[model samples]
Target: MLRTILRREHKNRWERRAALVPESIAQLAAQKIPVAVEPCSIRAFPDEAYKAQGAELHNDLENFQLVLGIKEPPVASIAPQQVHLCFSHTIKGQPYNMGLLQKFIDQRATLIDYEPIVDERGVRTIAFGRFAGIAGAIDSFFVLGQKWLKMGKPTAYARIKQTKDYPSLSEIKSELAQLRVTNDKPLHVLIVGTGNVGKGAKEVCQWLGLPEVAIDEVLAQKAPKSSWFSVASARHLHERIGGGAFDYQEYLQLGKAQYRSIFDRLLGQFELLIQTPYWTDKYPAHLDIARMNENMQALPLVVGDISCDVNGSLKCTKKISTIDEPAYSYFVENDGIQDGIHADGISVMAIDNLPCELPVDASRHFSAILTRYVPELVKMDLNQTLTHSGLGKELQRAVIVYNGTVMPEFTYLQHYLDRHKLTKPSEAS
Candidate 1:
């Protein structure tokens, strides 16, 4: 696969939103791989989670090379996907923190290196899913099909066994009803940040019994003036001393000289929110957070800063399910051994060794790209000789709940039988 490289003004901004990433870089350059577009903006690195797509690949770095970008392709400040392959990128290379910028809120996790593919694939395949931190660079290649394949196949890889358990709540309600969100209603969420993604979206909404709502300063100080709303990270819109007159535990230590208008007045009560990558750039104080909520027909939940504002927004054309980073699979890093065949002969590589790369081929390429976005096992018709796609140990079909709901939305809060205001004491008065 010779060259590859591309970005060409992010391929004319996803070809004016018709997106195919320039027909999949002209079918990966017909197949030989020589591709090379580069006007630039394929992001994910050091700290560039869309700094206007790294200032537009820093004024178009020379137009082309051997690139095939989605994340890592920018270089000049020092980026060869960050030298000799840091080989982590399962989805995360930027966003240690953002705008209201909590300065990496404590940042960690970046210690990859197994040693130049440990001599010829001793182990390595990291096909990412869940927390690869901040992912986004997938191409899931194919001139073929993807409308949830049934038509001769473009996606159906398998290997999910070490004992399986993924997408079952009717495969995450048929992948959240293939993300239609035009009007299922229930998506008002607002979480913000502090850690463990606001306790995992309050434990995936008390494990999906759903309903937690919290953006009150008495409803953002009775927002009216013909509400379409605009807190813009509260740079200065003081409605007679603004919402709940400061004291949410003393403004959580007055960080960012006051939570950039308290997370823009708690995301102006919700056009569908959920932040925390420390809230990037801290904004005019809102630099396009959750589609800046003036109500583009509602329905948003830009969680954990992963979908990078719905795939680097110019303004939501739709179709966004980003987690980031994609290269199929490759790694063996941590440059240690190599001069011991005597020095070059013994060669097994890696001193830090994050499990000799390839933990079951990076857990079966993150369980076949997270079971192709978990359509809750589309009612499994398996047994036709079973391939499901690749690396295998299990998944002939297993996932315990995304619909019947269980496995891990925070274990449905130990079956809470609703207590607290169990009344009585007030009746005595």
Candidate 2:
């Protein structure tokens, strides 16, 4: 029988999310599963809550077999032969996390990344994307209020607060409901994508009394009501350069080289953009830098980059800001960044961990999805051949490294890791 431990996250002091909520633990407790949660100082769920649910809280990990975390664990804290589960964020061969990956290799520990955990159809099984969208939307509104205040035109949104300041999503909505734009000009908000993240963002937009409109309605010359928002999915976002009907599979195969985003054409139509697309290197740039310069005077002033992929999809998303300093200015003229919001440039809210601002809500949302797979996750047996085990296969497929060796699916990362160690010898520890 595998003994699982829910470890505390120490990646950032502000990172208060937990891998499993107390409600999820209670379910495991009812089944008499061998699992324990270490007391954490900053976790959204208090130690008393887990204790109330019959979960043992402690700092020692000597007896635990598997450790679950929200983020990557510190290299020094990982026990040898321990099977770890978390969002390692190393699939991309990120330069900063190379040392952490190397530590796993040296320690003979297995790493099962949550980001890559997918079902048979390859849809991600666990995520905090929706909460991220909710937080991103709220923050974007706050940025708008700040910008308006700086311009000496205060609005009802000026009374709005940060996501963490609110106890729950309901309270956030209550505040949004009271918001009334001070000016006669309508706030034309464009939300990109329609996934879980987009849905959450849309919820916030709707609660703010923003009328949701279709893509065709957005292109109309007539302006929306004082508070209105529009949603655009993949069909409305891009077009085939060769002028044929867009095929999703063909687009994926051909990548960005074939598809061009039509998003820039309607740049001046909206005042704010709430981006929620899942971006990768293979995807086409959503907002072209050259086109943005050409339409600088007409472009949106505020951009809520919910995807938060630094220098990935959106050209203006030059850097990932923190919750403390969530908004930054992207100057189109100089192609440079200002630390905070500036009247001369467009303000971008691109905090990478937007979900962290609403830690409790995000944890609960994440736990709902993760709890369904806990029974199968805890049944994973390292000693047995993964091929013969039914429950273990789910976890086995997500395992990037097993017993210090790179798994078959992740073999390509070997060269990247080798190069990382050579360039930065200090990370070899």
Candidate 3:
């Protein structure tokens, strides 16, 4: 029933990056999907403006299908506004759409929760269930990340070391008290990987009440952590006076000696290294990333950069652990080449839900991705299955609505209430 779709303009810096994708790659995306480009905007909404000729939003719904670029929550309630999503609504603040509205509820789903240390199912069962309300959004690839994706930029894992400069016991105690986490020692941590993910990791460390260091700050200084050392970018080495590939030995002998002295001249303070994994089609960054790891055969490291190699693959099983890794990615990935850490290396950690960080700002445009496509989505999803009958009685007993509203069961209603609370009353109202 749908034929043409419009790609929204990239307004945000991140979106701008996503939009400027090279022609070859854009063609590759179009290989199977017959997608056409048009600037999508919510202004297309029927009542949006000076309607001297007040008209229906769609002049021809039959021919053109509006495809929401992003998936938004269902708003079964009235007067939709600001990421509006709902099940049922009240006229006098009382149920207007009942049982019919409840039908849309996706309830009684088992939620997969995990704790590092556990028994029963053992720690292996890190994820295997569902829940009442799980926040879902378009986080697979950030707009800026899309830019980097198209650029095929290099990624690295950054690790910051904690040295004497690290907070003392008193300071650690002071900060821990604020976060409600208690520790005997100052609790040194290493964060690796660079770019956005690394920045996010530093923020998380700060959240966990730990000291951190980034590579940029370290690189600027003469005395980096005495313990671990980072080499140089492989890409940088290529721009020599003559311009020919240098052999490993000659490369080492000729390049900055800082890398060589790293091991032998340990800065006297490092326990870990966080390195990114992404390497561009360009060889320099890749070789640099690999060489750094090859030399430091001792210190522990946490590689946060999930994407590396051609295609920016997320596969990590090749190195270790096959739990397949969770989508924790990055909550707010930023290029944190500064602050947050004490160690000396750029970090690379994956950050998820970048758009949601400021959805209102993003909503300004993401809504375009959604509003334009929603009707088709609605029509397309008309026959698509959504209910989870597998839950059985737990569903019946737990679910309050199925093609209706008012699921009193906590397994259902509680979640709806919680999500509604996330938005301002006027918006969610």
lDDT of each: 0.26, 0.82, 0.28
Error of 3 at 357 (Å): 12
lDDT ranking from best candidate downward: 2, 3, 1
In model 1, which range of ten residues has the least summed lDDT?
A: 135-144
RMSD vs true structure, all candidates: 26.4, 2.1, 21.5
The digit string of per-residue lDDT tens for model 3 on 1-429 reads 334343332323222211112232233234433333333343222132212222123322223332222321133221111111211232112232322233233331111111111334422211110100000111111111222233453211101112112222244224323542223222223333333444433444443444444434444454332222333333322444444544555644554422222322222233322333333332233223334445344322223333323223222112221111212211112312332211233222333223323323333333333233223222332122224333222223322332223434434444444544454365745
Q: Against the true structure, whose TM-score is highest?
A: 2
Model 2: ten consecutive residues of lowest lDDT: 384-393
Ranked by TM-score from best down, the candidates are 2, 3, 1
Which digits, one per residue and each the tens of the lDDT, describe model 1 over residues 1-429? 112233332322211111113333333334434333334333211113222222222333333212222222222222221111122222222231011011111121111121112213332332222222111100110100121132332222111110012223233323323433222333334444434334533443333333443334325555432212121212222221344464444444453454433333443344323333332232223323343345333333222232333322212211222112111111112212222111111111111111111123323333343223222222222222223422132232211111122224223322321121232245336
Please give the RMSD of candidate 3 to the true structure: 21.5
TM-score of candidate 2 on Cα atoms, chains taken together: 0.94
- What local lDDT does model 1 show for residue 64? 26
- The local distance difference test score of model 3 is 0.28
Off by over 4 Å in 1: 1-66, 73-170, 175-189, 192-273, 276-429
lDDT of 1 at 136: 12
- TM-score between candidate 1 and the true structure: 0.23
